[model samples]
Target: MADRDFLLWPFLETRHRDWAEEVEAWAAANAARLSEGDTDEAVRNLTRAMGEAGLLRMAVPESGRLDVRSLCIARETLARHSGLADFAFAMAGLGTGSVTLFGDPALREAWLPAARAGTSLAAFALSEPEAGSDVAALSTTATRESDGHWRIDGSKTWISNGGIAATYAVFARTGEAPGARGLTAFLVPAGTPGLTIAERIEVSAPHPLATLRFEGVRVPDAHRLGAPGEGFKVAMATLDVFRATVGAAALGFARHALDLTVARASGRQLFGGPLFDQQMTQAAIAESAVDVETSALLVYRAAWLKDSGAPRVSREASMAKLHATEAAQRVADRCVQIHGGHGVVRDHPAEKLYREVRALRVYEGASEVQRIIIARAERARAEEAARCKPTP
Candidate 1:
């Protein structure tokens, strides 16, 4: 949407650049669907279009490896254009992340290929009404019967792609033990016998979020993603791969907002001079830019860490996600202030960007959760270093 370069110092190859350009062109042309009033049609059409364009194939790895950097880059670029565009691309990767990470060949073959082809819409159903950040509190349970069939009975709220998703990766309590250890991941189809859409959730920005009701929904044991008590582990692995993209999406929104701010502040006049002439306005703009650049560095660094064979990127990911999302919120707020009255107008692009960016701070992992995670990791790393160092 803006002339500013998006890729910060080229974290990718020529293919990535070519793909980003092509997708941007396509996104620019199809941008109308983003403002469409119907949420369901928008998601379905956008996802199918991404699939047909071959962008959706990037969601699944050829073998079992995920390129976190590529996913984050795609989300950043798409989020810069439209939130729906980002959703289309992100759902393709995230919805099937567990399958690629832990599912068996046959399961992967059945779902991953179909997902890549856009024939099947996948979603992750893990959060319950009470299990926002503390996933260990999930009440959804899957019990194995003598018939060897798994019966899942649980309620999942705040689920993305809820009503329209063709399939969902559901994490349920296996009744195996206690706490996070007893959870198991299941591949639940949309049309499963007892599965129902309890309600369609409406948030600030319209998306196909919904509450899922699973009552004795039976699937073969073959659909189990990882071993019992491994659902949290599987979900963590998925989050680790995609969480940076959450920040990227925020960065994209912030970039859009910044462009809008610069355009307005440079031209819009107050007190006989341009808005940019005001000291407060200039300071805000400068602060916003720093946030953007700093956020990009964190996002790419975390992405690089993962791609560089780092065992775990908890601290890096938390820093990236926290900084990027919080920064985007500030950036969007600054853009609104720069635009003055026009920013709040329904027709203004910043107005939409404002709504789109707010969700990133809360989803994936909330800012508070990120802070907690970062503090916990920092403490652990410090303690380990303390223990390993030779005393003087």
Candidate 2:
């Protein structure tokens, strides 16, 4: 029961509203299940449950056309109830996104159904020990064999669903050329001969993550996604779609935090009245509300642009992610401030939100990276404008 008012905006349709309701109902019903069990195990259980409940089917629908609005609505609604549940749903789509967009017919037939059904987990392995933000710096290598197989050798870190995934979409240098042009994406199943989970990574909020090693792991050329040199394009295209949804998830966190703040402000007493009676308190709530609305605008605008067949939405997507994530962090901080000392205590909603929102700012693309992207896009636009100007 997070805010439904945002759904009324022009960016959403009746189907979006219906889907949001369905996801919200599903999340509420499964709240207890999502919160129970070991942290890592709980995430797995939730993923399975999401699949069983048919919630994940939309992620890789049979139509093969990804509806960005549906994805954003799903993430926003699930995030309101449980961040872990949101993570489970998101990873299912993200890990398999490259395949959906670029895999050949056989590869898609082999892997996508299992992923959508949650029968098999998936991971995207691109960020390595030395190369995260800079895709060109990745040193993982995939050498060709006489048998037409490829041998992958290197490591990847900060991989989501790393240890538990049944398949990993690994990007390695195939040496077609230097830097980004040389990289290639391969679909390496988890139990392949020379692939191993080197270490599990821990963060403030618990989830299944790890560093993976590829020691001469070999897969048929058939497993390669797209062409030999299209890996970077595949990654970028996938990210363009999901990055907007990341903003939607951040909006969910901010919404929950705002709800908690409002509850506390309306009930708590200070001096002789409710804490919300003060002008200062009113201002903070108003500001948070504005932040939430603006974030939704940016998120859905990018999503809408993509769904309408925009070939590239790098600028809009970056703006949405950058603004929404940073705004969510600020809103979370404000909520904590409004809650007084209770905000810092463990297990509290505000406290949990504080931790959950921090990572969104760093992952996908960091805030700094988003700024750089936005600046570059603006400069390009300006140059084009100047070039098109009439002689004066």
Candidate 3:
């Protein structure tokens, strides 16, 4: 019943709206049931349930297919209610995203259905302690043996769904070469010999985040995501898709904040009248509404470009993620300010939103990274245009 029509605009179809509403209803009824007393356990349970309900189907497209719009819509709805809900939905997509884009049939058949059924959980293993954003700094190494097995060593930290994932699409250095060129990806199962959980990281908002140490673990060559040194490409491609959805999540938080602020302001009285009558309060409402609309436009525009068959939405996705996240932080701050006293208190939507929006800006390429990406993309476009001159 909470109106998210503002986010739909021309970017969505009736089908998308219907799907979003259906998922939202499912989440409301089932999320509480899925909460397993502990936060991390709850997320794992939600993943299985979401898969069984067929929600994880959108995570992987049906052969040579991609539904970027569906992914964004699902994320938007999930984040609007609970951050954990959004995490459950996103992991379903990203945990196996590398495989979805590039896996062989055996790989796909073996993993896709389990992920869809929520019987198994998936994870992306790219981030390392040294490689927070500069992925070239990854220390994990994968050396190929004469028997066609790959030995994986080193560790990964700050990994989402880390310890809980039944399977991990892992990236590691393949040689002594520098930068991202030496990297490769492999499918490392949870029970793989010499692999163990290093530590469980306790974040502000509890999720199943951890550090994984892979010591002399062997994975078959068939487990590779792509060819040797394609790990960077795999990692970048995955981030490109997920980064935009980070904006969608931000859009959800903003939508919720705006709703809360509007409700609070309309009823709270001042000067022998409702707060809505005050010029200052009216301006605040106008500003928040504008922020929400502008962010939605950017978020869905990126989704449309990818769904329309445009290859690699780096520029648009970066722009969307940057603007939507920064905008959501602003909107949440304004909501807190508008509420005066109750804003900072926990369980109040605004208070939780404030914490929820913080990680969005920091992770998946920070706002600063997005600005750099946008500028570099523009520079590339200008260079391409100059090369194709009229020859006057």
Candidate 4:
């Protein structure tokens, strides 16, 4: 069973606690079946199941308001049971996040309901083969046509829910301004005239990733998200809301590792005693506990700040992602060490966790990128504070 104590923290309200409990119950019952067999089919089935349970509705709230805490709780709880299930749920929010935040009523009516219903899968297409973190360097171009449509030309790689997504929120260079300012987001429905699945990307922990090619795929002007030259802002705003939940997912993985470690240590016998009897084993478990709690605090702090209406939380969110992902990696490593050869064996709980915990540190901004974001934000804050100091 997953840890429920974290939900009692002051960062969460009563409603958040109740929602966490409900999600945990549902995930426990469904995660295993949703996780079985072929990866692609499992993800597709899980997507529909999550929608049927009304969990996907939380991603697009009634008033079109996004509650960051709810997202964090959902990801954390779902991740504790199945990483693939959590990925499906996260993409549902992330893929259509721009529409929820910036799309017009028509776009929302067209996509959001289908996404929430699991009738149509959604994907966010921003990263390209050459441009991953450098949003300004994206070469995907969307040229305005004489017919009041936009013709997109370029390829996007590493797209989540890639081939199966019903629609993609794609970013492209419109040349409306310069660099990042020139980019714009467009809603590209699957099976469009010139769109193709370029290649399927299989990773260590896979859940439907692919490279997409757009050879003059034209979309109606009505499909554009937000104003022209505002794609960067739209993407950032959406990421800012969901990034903290990435940390929550990491926290869940770490907690699961710790639980497995405890069981292994208590039940295994060595030298006429339990494996946990050794001081070294006890110290390792202690460190794992500290790491788990620390990660939880950071994750919830960012989530609470976002929920409380903070305009910008790049620094907090970066810190949370950086610390939680790194800490979870450490916790998983320690659990593997404790499990010895069994940890290295495939299909073992610890072994599976070892692979699942890796991508979090790299995606959603690498650990190095998060450090840069935090340092830059701190330096700016310090400079502002220095400027306001009165001279004696």
Give the CA lDDT, 0 to 100, for residue 105 in model 1: 94
lDDT tens readout by residue for model 4, 1-392 = 75678888899999998898888888989987789999888888988988888889888655677888899899888888999989998999999899999989988987798789776889999999999988999999999999999999999999999999999999999998999999999989998999999999999987799999999899999999999999999989999998999998998899899999898999989899999999999999999999989998998999899889999999999999999999999989988998999999988889989899999998878899999999999999999999999999
Model 3 whole-model lDDT (C-alpha atoms): 0.87
lDDT of 3 by residue, 1-392 (tens): 45676545887888888888788888788864675479878898888888878888888665636577888888888787778888888988898899988788898888888888888888988888888788888888999999999999999988889889999999999974678988998888899999999999998767889999999999999999988888999988888788889999999889889998899898998889888888888898899889988998999999988888878999999999999999999999989988988998876778888888988898888888899999999999999999998897
Candidates' TM-scores?
A: 0.96, 0.98, 0.95, 0.98
- Model 3, C-alpha of 175: deviation from truth (Å): 2.6
Candidate 3 residue 14 C-alpha distance from true site, Å:
3.8
Better of 1 and 4 by lDDT: 4
lDDT of 2 at 286: 93
lDDT of 3 at 322: 97
lDDT of 2 by residue, 163-249 (tens): 999999999998888889988999999999999999999999777889999998999999999899888888899899999999999
Cα-based lDDT at residue 104, candidate 3: 87
Task: List per-prediction Cα lDDT, in the order shown.
Answer: 0.86, 0.90, 0.87, 0.91
What residue runs in model 3 are displaced by over 4 Å at the alpha carbon?
A: 6-8, 32-36
User: Each prediction's Cα RMSD?
Assistant: 1.5, 1.1, 1.8, 0.9
C-alpha positional error of residue 29 in candidate 4 after TM-score superposition, expressed in Å: 0.4
For model 4, what is the C-alpha lDDT against the true structure? 0.91
